[model samples]
Target: MNKVKILNLEIDNLSKVEFLDTLQSGVVFTPNVDHLMKLQKDPEFVQAYSVSNYKVCDSQILLLAARLLGTPIREKISGSDLLPAFYTHHQQNESIKIFLLGAREGVAAQAQQNINLKIGRNIVVGSYSPSFGFENNDLECQQIVEIINNSGATVLVIGVGAPKQEKWICKYKEQLQNIKIFMALGATIDFEAGNMKRAPKWISQIGFEWLFRLLCEPKRLWKRYLIEDIPFLLLILKQKLNLYLTKDYLKKNSKDKRHSWHTAGKY
Candidate 1:
């Protein structure tokens, strides 16, 4: 698997079909700009990402960033698209039973029903919607593990949110002995349950899906799109100019404000 380096991570440079064919059962996490920014400071999230078997490009912004850095990715495989593709690709394979975890109350169950109906079989064997902050509760998490294990699911699709979902899977994956594949796919369960709308293909193709989402839920996403993630473009520019600091150098000098990032060595 060829990879393209973007800042602190190497994204698998595989097309949708190629990725589907290559995956045999391992951790999958889609990296976008927000995730990239988080990786810069969140040590726990970084560790979770380090355990990922496949880190694929999940944003057109990242695709453009890769192209600007002279390593163009083959495709943008967002979780919204990948989930549908996975079930469709394995429609006839009985060994691919899936368990969905996340979304609001009752949403994961609805997604299970919808996906199984679409696949014409019970490809999705179980679904659970964890309460808010459930990741912090050891007892609830244990119950969730038992529920999934008892369901005989081979694939676990968790979609609560980014670092939480990724970190939780990394922490408890071993307890669920039956799971072969673990995917931390944000908000895909909501989309699958028809609780939210996705941007049209044309908008997504033109790299405006973020803008579409911003307009749809300004109150919930304004900071992520408008304020917090504004530095991604500058970081990409630093990479293009060969001024981005290597991971070790950044760690050693992280507390030394005098070491200018603009004068840093290559990543």
Candidate 2:
């Protein structure tokens, strides 16, 4: 399992085909520019990422950054793309039962319906759309867990958002003893449900999908894309010039060293 170092995270250096063919059972977290920026100051998010089995590149900008830094990633495996590929790849595998969690009301259900129709079978067995701040309510979290458990789903695809989605999975994965795979894919459920349209292939290829999203929901994503995440480019420049303090970043993450991403073994 070779890895490409991108700032604080080490992304798996696996192509889409390689990953889809080999991955069996483990947690997957796709890191984008916003996620990287959050990781800089969000200790809880860092802790959640520490326990993940896979951290793959989810942003085309990150992929380009990797190339600029002289260690190119094989591909960009965004959550929106990964989810569809995953379901289609395992369409015939009866054991690959999935549960859709997150998105707005009815979104996950709609995604389940669409995916089932595409696969010609019910690959997505269950769906749930948690309420606002549902993660903070212990009882609600437990009830949702039970619902997923009762649904008999082996794979859990959660898409509430970053940090929240990752942290929730990290906290409750143990309780989900029946689940074999956990995927924290932001907004993918919406894409599958057709509630949101993805950027055109050409736009995505040029690494401007963030602009497309910002254009779509300017009020919601402006700060994320234009304001808060601005430091990512400077950090990439620092890395390229060998000015990034890797030691300091590692020291910040040292608290979670006890958790090993490879403990469950690779596919």
Candidate 3:
């Protein structure tokens, strides 16, 4: 697979591009916003997937990914970048076939309908609502995999929430090898499905989407947003500080052969 490059982001494989292009052709890419934010502070996390030829980016990356289809370049972007790309792709009639998975009962269907209303009909291929704890069931897992495989979907968007969605992709990657793009979209399916509401555009722009979500589901999300998020931020800060300190130390101690000349030859 060829690598696609856009700005600082690089897509290592063309399989996803080819698949989407052949199916929907010009659909915008949408990824998990939270994951994108995490990647900004943790390049290692981004690189881990990047090296695997996976483009784990947000909306912006999706936009760039759409543009680089069949082109020889890398695709890298964020959520903010996807809106415009979607519009452009829509105008070009190159939309990709999307499959929405996860979320509450009927949420996937609702999300698909909403996206179709927003992006147009046929943009979404299908939607499925799995068992609440589908991840733990091997039989259910195989069943879902079979459904996805038979769907001939170009992009399979999993919204079963984190770690689980990620784990599912890792476990089924081999079985779904024919799948070009497999995104673990976390709550996006729920948000789209209307099971949850997304923050207003202004709030999202200001990076307060988490706050809005917490406001909507205070009892369920307060701990995660207020407590877990804070510690996560702190950990990110610590990691950054350590990286800076390490770089500074390396620079300070780096060998300078010119300054270490030996003058003891005469002795």
Candidate 4:
């Protein structure tokens, strides 16, 4: 497996370029600290990630934590970067049809338009914004699934944010027969459409993109970053310590085996 388990979640250790180039048609899960934390308690989220064929690192903070834990990921292949790059390069390939799902009412449509404009091709075939808690309503979920199936889209970019987007994929991706790839893109669609801005490159590189976002949307994000996500460091440390102990155990066992072999040879 080209993966490492940190805090009991499997992370693919592939670079951004490699991940994009080889990205197959399946659930594409991008988990940051917030998501990994949620996985501890949310069986649906665990099911979502467990079934993902592509599990790329979505957070620079997560990258840093991995490096410190002795399981360095190759790179961040976040949805924010993946969505635009995928369209920019693959839009010319007519076989790859796309659908934008789960932004605000008109935002997914706006993103579809912007992407088509930027790519100079109409790769996006459909756009839909499911209402809040629409997944809770079985009829609504089936309708959304049917709309996607009828659109003839090969890819579906979902921007409903964390657990909801992931849960939607877990429950409905297999039924979306037309969709080859399902991306839980969070706010990336809004960022792509100019409805919101992503963090600056330097800020993102330094692993403070969370802070930048928190500052930008303080009311909605402050508690997430400060309270919920801060405790994630403790989780990281615990994993690191566990990894260290395991390595030490392996080394000690190997050494003991070698000594026993030498003593047997002398006898």
Candidate with top lDDT is 2
Indicate the TM-score of model 4: 0.88
Which sequence of candidate numbers ranks them by lDDT, best first? 2, 1, 4, 3
Which candidate, 1 or 3, has the higher lDDT?
Answer: 1
Q: What lDDT is obtained when candidate 2 is compared to the true structure?
A: 0.88
Off by over 4 Å in 3: 1-95, 243-267
Per-residue lDDT tens digits of candidate 4, residues 100-141? 887677888888888888888889988998776676678988
Off by over 4 Å in 4: 243-267
Going through the candidates in order, what is the number of backbone clashes in each?
A: 0, 0, 20, 0
| TM-score ranking from best candidate downward | 1, 2, 4, 3
Local distance difference test, each candidate: 0.87, 0.88, 0.53, 0.78
Once model 3 is optimally superposed onto the true structure by TM-score, how far is the C-alpha of residue 108 displaced, in angstroms? 0.6
Clashing pairs in 4: none
For model 2, the stretches where C-alpha displacement exceeds 4 angstroms are 246-267
TM for candidate 3 is 0.61
Error of 2 at 188 (Å): 0.5
TM-score of each: 0.92, 0.92, 0.61, 0.88
lDDT, candidate 3, equals: 0.53
